[model samples]
Target: MASEELINARHAATAGLIACASAFVYLLARGYQARRTFYRLRQQGMPMPPWNFVLGHLLAVPPIMKTLPEDTQQPDAFEALCRANEKRDADSIIYLDMWPFADPMMVICSPVLAVQACQEHDLPKPPILHAFFNPLAGGANLFTMNGPEWKRSRALFNSGFSASHILEQTSHIVDEAEVYAKILRQHARKGEIFSLDDVTCWYMMDVIGAVTLDSRLHSQQQFNPLASALRRQIRWHVLDNEWNLLIRWNPARPFVQWYNSYQMNSYIAQELDKRYAEWTEDEAATSSRSIIHLALAGYMAQQKDKPRPRMLDAAFRDWATVQIRLFLFAGHDSTSSTICYCFYLLQSHPEAMAKLRAENDVVFGTDITETAKMMREQPHLLNRLPYTTAVIKESLRLFPPASAMRGGQPGIYLQDDKGNRYPTEGTNMWILHSAVQRNPKYWPSAMEFIPERWLAEPGDPLYPVKGGWRPFEHGPRNCLGQTLAMHDVKITLVLTAREFDIKHAYDEWDRLHPTSKVKSVNGERAYQMQSGGAHPADGYPCRISLRKH
Candidate 1:
């Protein structure tokens, strides 16, 4: 009996050993495959990181937190990673292996390579980004669409933002600016330090609402649904880093699609349904038209010529709401950021602010209403204020609204003016505007807030700065609203500077937190201005002394 038991135990032990050997063999095979793939990529002259069969570069990528802080949040996970990489002078291509079945992903930083990838013909937007921005109501908006669809939709929308149309919106813009100015005046009376960001956001919200929704968003009012929704969406896209993993997994595709659709579409649908019903009942009585009316007119015109393209099944009201939402998202945060940065820089450099005020005095002396009228009557006066224009330009260079992203699928090659080719396959190349603008190679004393750089003569060392100075981006996909944004920034600054002597009450001004699209200062999200957007916590803060013009 003892001998028989020992034989059975021996057999069981042998079986266990065989099982362990099989598992080891399988792991070895996986490691071999991964190594082969890595070496193959290297042989192709592609830049990549050394691979571990299990982690690839999973351990290398930074640990992104699930919940980010409200005040000092990094813009996006990718941006945070880029900043880290820049410090290390790491290779542009990173082999990211966050999950099983994950492909070798590349992160690009070179500008020329980025331009080629963005302008590529064969690449559709990566599924991850597309899933995030694809609106639920119907067809994709300009922000998501790629290739012919993106091109066509862009052209269609381009006409609406033409110079003439922007001019037509100025009256409404000025009215809102006046409201903002009054808000700042109240803060000035209290002799309190305030955030300029908050006030400017309210101003931007009002301007975008007027131009896009033909509605007034009283940003001063607490708990405005539209404003809340706008802020929520921006936070979702800009701050939610966890979405990156889900975006990577193809199995979670349905969930991603549902989330984006539900976030914007359902709310917009409800609003549109209510608006359409009211419009149907009141169309005959109304004379003064809104932006929605203009869009409807354009749609009707398109239909009259050729059967109107049913781009999306969204009702006119829903469509209008979607457009307004996008417009607000695009215009508000960016414009407000630029405005606040301008004030911050001006406050830091009083000489520039004084020069700007002097120019304001020479252009429109001692009368706020007269200045507004003059700005309206002789808009060209805007171009003539070299120092003022320089200030605006410099501010934009420091904080551009849109960060650059390259277009194309993985495996594409991008070449520079030199015969050097970059491996751009599946690369989301970034043109870090902040990094570019601050590069010491491009601007001498690049870190200083110097508006005089723009006014330099052709032969001046600063005048010959490279392509990094672009605020509106360069080439075909550049900002169509460049003229409009410029007009708004110029007028707001001129009006604000002329009426108020601004000062930074805080010991240190905030630095911009890197985000995907919009860049903002730390700890100054919402500020209390005497009379600006509403409060700096809701915007950015700046203390002001109201000047009697």
Candidate 2:
């Protein structure tokens, strides 16, 4: 009996080893097949650069990354890589074969191809988006969801961002901008250099809370748990230009993620519950027209013939909280980065600055002090400041924060104007916003800070191409808070553009920075970095002083 049992055990062990060997062989076969397929396609006239059969683009990416500074963002590197490989006149969409480290990516380098991917095909967001955001959002939110579920969620959340609703909520944005302006004033008085990015982030958060949830976080004035946690969580989300062992191997990161999620989730839930109760109680006389309130109303309206719950249901609360957090994260991050860049660009070019101030003076009245008050009373007047709006447009053209990251599908192939088609199967699709937006073929004087491009008539060379200016992106999956974001940036510009001049203190920042002597990338001190979002390096360390009118 013992001999029979030993023989059976040996057979089982042999079977297990064979299974493992077979799996390894299968993976090797897949790798070899991927290499042959992509290389052969490229040789047959695909615009993609050659790659190593064994290492894929794993070895390729780091060498290109080495061109820019250590802190230069992946988006920035994407442009550099594309520029190195792309034919100036050819219809180009560069494909990088990143394996094991990241998913294989087919980057859309031209606005025409971008339109094909985003509009024509309307591809779903990549699974990596969900993988990256799952921890941050608690689960898949608007930015990550795809297909039928995505469509349903998108429909439910649409009413909250209607122009009418956003108009109702512009005052909240102005209110928060006033607090931000006051904080800037205090910074100005101190005559000290500080992080415009950090402070701007706080202000955006406050605005998000007020406009979205009808709550006063007062993050600018004091320490807020939600704000702190959000920062930590967001920082944790940034992929290092290197191997990123700081995050990958840190055992404490899981606890940190849990704690931060708990804090943000708890705060969002508590605030949402208050609004939920308010909606339940009144229904008709709903005093607040915040984004979060409208979203909740939208979700509730979708309940066909279901009995209304006295309290918030689990599914309702969970889904609602995730959307609210999405608003909080997306609203604050990209908008804040734009605000910093607006300051950085305006200070860099005084001609544009003069025109901006002149426009503001004409629109907001000569007394810059009253711009905030004027904006709050008549928020629609911001729409009237075409040049001011144009400056924000131009700033976004130069420094778009993020884009809709779509996954490559089996049958989808992006076709350019030249009739060139590229296969996108089994890969992640990314439209390099900087490359597409600033491509000289699309935008004349693309590298220059030209606000007039947005203002020029259709026949003119400087006029924006139809699909070129995609800072907030285009198509159905475009940014929901884009209108709000435009208004928020305009309001901040109105409040601060004339009152204070914030200039980059990069040289001083580098001198003062204890650990980082690393300053500037390709002579751009204010280059954007991929830290949670495309943000100015070192929070755009700068000195602020009162502008002499």
Candidate 3:
């Protein structure tokens, strides 16, 4: 009886403690401490959009139902709302309290301010912004790290992704492209309507897997669960529900993520372990200059001293695995979106397609067999396809794969060039792509598909704006795989244009998904938001046929 009474008493006490903790967290999240931070920033004269108590400016976010028109007064619904809030107020910085208990974000649209944010080494990416992607980095990889660690990781990847290095990997890339070309050719023969988005994704997964990890995922041949999971993971990173405690805390959620992570990490670990063992057995036996080889050699060299570096440890293993996953997550979907959009844009504009085809024919030659042979032997000839490259630039300009974000230092507010002080303390800075790429101030006919703008000579009016275009971003933290990504894109274009002419399979797509409305650009249906990257709404339903010489 005495013991029973003691157990009851303990249970009651524990329940009380949990309740109190819950209340404390609720108060902190429901504008208790966060409200204090808000008022402090407001007191500093920060420009703020009207926000409600809990949801903040979430209500201001335009619904997906509201279509983005090509010739609309507003470029996008978000930008439209920002302009509406800025009526008579000329502040370039807009503040939005996205979460009830979180610090309001400072949305920096001014390019001048953006340049400062990009250039400042002290400014870091906010942890909250990257919480979704932390799993990919295991809390220690390049994308999540800041300061000295970031610099070290960035330097380590530089040599591997350089122009000369990516140039050497062209044969592998071409081989992958050939397999992809054969797949598409098979589809063309059947008069099948296929998803360019899907095929490009498979090809890129194969290329990045081969080049980065020296593993052939064979994504083109069959369904790779790891590739699918990585794609899904990238999409999940941008979801609003990703932060919801109820969903995140659900048992099934972590189980799925853990399973995928385990599978991917295990495969990468096996490869890493095998490579390390082989090199240890005989370093001269493994002389291939793959990215993983170079990285492992560098780590081994660093650890030759007294204290061994963490490169060969569990954390390093996870980090290496995460990077391969990151390449798939970051590289595959993004490049796929870009290539998919390129085909979509070309199909919509026959004139542009003709021009691109003409350029490819002249540079790559009209004979498919000869062209394939030449591409395999002299892959660098891809550099001569300037017009095709311009079309890609235009596609990227219209649809940037990602947006730029940076962290706001504790007390420092960003000041615009015109002496306007914008409060940024305790805030994450978002440089929205719509504001930069589609802003009329930067490019003429911002909503139109104009590849010639990129092709403009120095003294021409259509020349790209000096600081306006940043598809790959511009700074110390620019994409490490920019050259490789562009090369892959260009190679895909060269190979495809040589053999097939792609057209939009609108009829089949519409019949299957009647409820879907494709997003419009310049009064034409073109773009759609899918997962993380923008793709044609109908999964970019494409019909390919052999091009007549």
Candidate 4:
């Protein structure tokens, strides 16, 4: 009986070994296939960095990262990689192979190529993006949806983001911006440096929260659960650009991710249910007429001749949970970065800063303290500040939070102006907005901060070329929240630009830390880094001083 038991144990151990070996072989085969396909595309004229079959282009990431600080976040590596390779306008498209982790991804540096993929082709978002965003939404939303589902979602949400609607919501936006300005005032009073990014993140939370559902989440003033969860979700998120495999695959990550999702989704779902309850009751229930309520109305319109249900459909409610989550996350991350960079740029360029203030003061009055109140009273007046608008545009062009990332599909290819076709199958597609926007080939003096580029006449050399400046991107699938984002940024700038003189505190931060690496990206101290979405490095530590008028 003992001998029989020993034989059975030996057989089971052998089976486990065999299974492990087979799985290893399968991964090896997949890796080889990726290399073979990537090399074939390279041979066909797609520019790629020197390769390491096992590590793929990840081999190149470290060398570029070494040039900057160690703790710097992702995407800075890819942008640095482009510069290191001396990638030129002619070299419009570059492909990188990242196998056994992520699929191969391509970066389009030329506007012509960007349009081909984003505008003309309108390619679907690759699966990897869905995987990246899964922890946050865990289901289809506007940003990730493609084809029919995307079309339907886009139509439904379009009304909420219409130009007229955004204008109407301007006063609500100012309410939040006023809170943000008050926070800045507190910082000014302390006479100590503070992280503008930190406060901006909170302020944007309240703005979008208020605008979306009339949510009174005063994240700026106090600890807000929804806001905290949103930040955690981004911090916990492992983007493809996060090159650390171990961190990406950490076991602890799932629990935190699941919790954050639950916390945020439940919070948003309650809001939805409350609104739906109001929606169904024709007893003239008080409604916020929020972006979400408008969206819910749109959903009801799609019911056609079906009987008006007493309760929101469970399935639609479930889907709307993820979409609202998308709005909160996307709105907060993208605009926060823009606002920080605008301040950083204006701080650096005193001339442009003066021009911005002049525009604001002339439009809203030199009594800077009263501008926020006046803006709320006559929100339409905010539209009259062209130079202020120019500053925001230039900031976005210089440091776009992110571009539209599309998934490659079978039978689809991107074409350059020369009519050369580049197959996009089996790879993730990116327009690499930073590259296209900052390239001197596309915009003269591109590396410099110039707001006038947006206002240049037809004959000026600094004039923005058609299809070149794509901060919010261009085409059918362009950002749905663009009008609102612009209004949000503009409102914040209007309220704060004249009242406070904000400047980067990187020098002091470096002094205190004493061991930080190279402080600038091509001589600009406030470089874009990955936080939520392309946030400024180290949350843009800066000191705000009340400008003495």
Candidate 5:
């Protein structure tokens, strides 16, 4: 009986050894396959970064993440990488094997190539972004969908952004600008160092709420819950690298998605429910004049035509959430960033500020309300404000709100005007606007904040210089809210310039905290402004006094 037991034990040990050996062989095979794929891509003349056997370019990922101070550095790093690659005349393809994926990830820099990859429909949505945004948002929003779905959703949203609609929104934007002016006047009287970033973000939030939801919100007011929540959500989505890691790992993604849905989507739904209920109870009896009302009316009309669409109630609610969220996100951060940078540049170049104020004085005389009215009455005045437009344009070029990326799939090709074909298959390509905007090749004296570059004559060789522009990006995938953004910027500048002569309180640019998404001049997350809204922590501290002009 002892001998029979020993034989059984020996057999079990042998089986265990065999299973361990098989597992080792499988891992080794995968490693070899990944290496082989990397080399195959290189041989096909594809641009790629160096990779480790198992982790592709992940070792570099952490460094890239670390280089930026969560608020400004990520965007800056992306721009820096793009500039470095452009200098090398190398295609913008960074190899990333952070995942157990088939090929190295590619980042695209060239505008023509980015347009081809994004608009030609040759590339698939980046898997991480797709899974994170689409599933969480219910696959109905423009940012999440691809191919036919994206096309349809885009069609619906595009109708509301037609030229006429943009023009019509200008009056509303100017109204908000008056509010900003009043706030700045009050702050200036108190002589406080205020955070323009926070104030501007709130300003934008209120604007989006009014325009999209038809709800008036005092976003700039201290202790506003909705505004605070919106700010928190923005900070997380734009600045959090841990979230990025979770999304990269497939197994952990569902949990991350659930967390995001719980935090963002559900919260938004609750807010909407409360607002909708209030509207039904109090405002339904009166004529509604907000964009939300218009959208709801349009939606109802469409639903009446087709009674049995898929998840009609859920879709409408989700659609409203998307519209509001998109506007809130886009409006708040983009506008705030623009305002911060504009102030920075203006302060750095006092001559530019002087010129801007001079122009403001000529356009509006002495009254803030008159200035607002003139801005609306002569929209062309904005287009014609050579130096003001130049400064705004230059700032946007340096610190774009959105970074553009392209995904790789089979049969995808991007050919430049020079006939340089860059493979877009099975790779990711990103156009860092900061990099493109600041390239010395594209803009001579790239590091200098010179608004004059944009004031050159249309046909002049220096006009926009090659590869130097595109703050709003070029082609179909560019910012959909460009018009609205421009309007907001114009209104804010006009109002702020009218009330105060803004100057940098901090000596250097380093005073601001730079993050991946928003650029803050000061290390603090919020700035105390002497006038107007609180500046973002990543923005420079600028002092403003009543304008002597």
Candidate 6:
């Protein structure tokens, strides 16, 4: 009787526990369903692509999530997709499936919508999606900051990257360009197949190093660890692979990333401490050459009246580190890619090359050494290179280095050209730069390389379209270092073109891709480049020769 009674009590306790467990799970599922329903209701009026369970639209899947499609490999694939969607519903917001359980994102392709998002309504950046940018640019940096904080941080940087300040540093880029030309000449002598994209990146790194650190990083000659680390961090952040998975799951990848970050942060901190001490110790001895010096001066001037902020040392270090990283990464990569594309485009279109070279000769004169001397002594000559400027402009129009992203706030909306309003709440907005810049309505024969379009008279049909050409973007948050980028590109083009005549290594191109030629941007049966930038997938393999007199 006692054993039977004990068994009965044990069975009752078991039943009680199971009942509680089932009730808890039921409530949890009910809550999840309610949230999902709320999200679906929010997206009721929006035009979205078909979404899969747990994948949403799968558009924002990390690079590791699936095999890259051939169609999606094109640099302008996103723009192409956006164009297709616009045809279906011109006034509707184009939705992109991010991760499941997250808000769906919408892309803004129209200039009117882009301008409205940026100017009239201040849209914040999407949260968590831009985590990749956090390590390089901290939360406090201009890229990550919002509202009043961004304005304050941006103001300090303006002193260093202003038009006048950038022009003053023109000789610095000219000197860097000379060094780059020497390296290219060596490669030309060997008749080697080198990656033009890689070489251009190295040259731009050296240029940025000189401007920001006031030191020749010598990255072109020797590999710099910081530069390597920065590149690796970005590579890992974007391209997820076995190594990146280990980075998330295992300790080894994390260690490598941490070490690189530490090494870079330590170097920048030491440099900041040394420079600040020098400035405080001696004013006359402090040569204000680098952006670091200029920004520090601005900080000091601003802080003189206001009370010292807390943790000023750490804050300034972070500020300087972000700026250095920005210049090193964005400043270098964008301009270098632009330079590589300029060469690639010019090689394909010999007529454009001839026109550019003629302009260089007319403005810079035929003597290469004399031109170098003038570049060093007369920086103002850069302003007179109008056709060269136009060439760079047209190249940028074809290939914008980066696109703009804006997060929608409550009550903020986008309007179509036909005056249709699209509510933006709970949606992320991306300004598709490639689509906007290449609109056929604004630019006739948009895919063709035509530098003359920029030189057209005001009343002419080929005249510069108002608000149509935004290579560096537009509005308050446009690229801060645009002037600097343009200056570097112009200097590199002039000096390099003056010394070397570049030609595409068509044999090597065939060897790299033995198959049929794919249609490039302008429906031309040319080497189809599959990349996010203007460079080819295989990189621009080219032969170079000293220009015949």
Best by TM-score: 4
Output the lDDT of residue 297, model 1: 48
- TM-score ranking, high to low: 4, 2, 3, 6, 5, 1
Clashing pairs in 6: 57-97
Tens digits of lDDT, candidate 3, 1-549: 999999999999999999999998896666655656666655765666665555566666545225553222222444555555652445455776766534567666556667777765347877775665655543456676788988877777678888987888888888898999999989889998888777787888888878887767788898776676665555444344233576546666565666667777777788888888777778795666666776677667766875643236776676667666666667676788888888878877889989988887788777767776787788789889888989999888887776677887756666665577675667778776656777675578888899999879987877876656666878887788888889999988888875778887767777876654334544545454545554555567788998887
- The per-residue C-alpha lDDT of model 4 at residue 456 equals 88
Per residue, candidate 6 scores C-alpha lDDT tens digits across 403-459 of 677787778767777666776776667776666777775678877788898888988
- Model 3: what TM-score? 0.89
Q: Global lDDT of each model? A: 0.59, 0.81, 0.71, 0.81, 0.60, 0.69
How many residue pairs clash in model 5? Answer: 44
Model 5, residue 517: distance off in Å is 20
C-alpha RMSD for every candidate: 9.3, 3.1, 3.8, 2.4, 7.0, 6.2
lDDT of 6: 0.69
Give the higher-lDDT candidate: 1 or 2.
Answer: 2
Tell me the lDDT of candidate 2: 0.81
Error of 5 at 291 (Å): 4.8
List, residue by residue over 65-169, the lDDT tens digit for candidate 2. 656767777777777777778765567578877665566778777888888788888888877877667777788798888788888877766776788777777
TM, every model: 0.71, 0.92, 0.89, 0.93, 0.76, 0.83
Clashing pairs in 2: none
lDDT of 3 at 92: 51
Error of 6 at 442 (Å): 3.4
1-549: candidate 1 lDDT, tens digit per residue: 999999999999999999999999987776566556655655665544444655665554444332223333222343345445432332233333333333344554444444454444334555444444443223455555667857855665676577776776677777788888888889889887666666677688778777666667676544556666555444434222244565434475455544654655555555444444554467663233454555554455556666544342355545555554565666676777778778877877889888998988887776666877777676667766888889988877655554555544455666645464555553345555555565554578766667888889988877725455655666666666677787788889877887787765443334333344222332233222211111233344456897765
Clashing pairs in 4: 126-407
Q: What is the lDDT of candidate 3?
A: 0.71
